[model samples]
Target: MNEFKCKLCDKKIDATPYFEVHEWSYNEHGELLGTSIFYCDICYSKYLYKEI
Candidate 1:
């Protein structure tokens, strides 16, 4: 079984219910950054519903 800790809520998940969005670090200038951010399913939903 696939397992991971949620980067946002720190919740331990035993299975992947949704597809993960792999992101490459980038800057405002479109340059590569050093770190990457991982979002959980809940966080990703919030991200998608975020107001612009």
Candidate 2:
């Protein structure tokens, strides 16, 4: 089993239920450009809608 990390919040995530991958192609200001995977539903929703 591989361990995954959320680039947005630096939370240790378990890669079992699969991951929702996102990009920082436009959120350079959020400073999450190249360090995270935006793991989980909450994170993905927040990331997609700038709820962070």
Candidate 3:
């Protein structure tokens, strides 16, 4: 399996239930500018709970 690290906490994502947080930014004109972040379940839960 491919290994991934959570962008928030730098924890290794080696199990189930990781998260992907995505954001997009667009100029006045139509455009596609986006970014994604990975998070482990712990950090993801903290994010959802606004603790981080």
Instruction: Give one clash count per candidate, in the order shown.
Output: 0, 1, 0
Considering TM-score, which of the candidate structures 2 and 3 is the better prediction for this target?
A: 3
Off by over 4 Å in 3: 18-39, 45-52
Summarize candidate 1's per-residue lDDT along 1-52 as a digit string, tens digits. 4455665566665554454444556669998645333346655531221111
Report the candidate with higher lDDT, 1 versus 3: 3
TM-score for all models, in order of appearance? 0.35, 0.34, 0.38
lDDT of candidate model 3 versus the reference = 0.52
By lDDT, the best candidate is 3
- Which residue pairs in model 3 clash with each other? none
Compare the candidates by TM-score and give the number of the best one.
3
lDDT of 2: 0.42
TM-score ranking from best candidate downward: 3, 1, 2
TM-score of 3: 0.38
lDDT of 3 by residue, 1-52 (tens): 6555655676765664444666776758977666444445766632221111
Q: Ten consecutive residues with minimal summed lDDT in candidate 3? A: 43-52
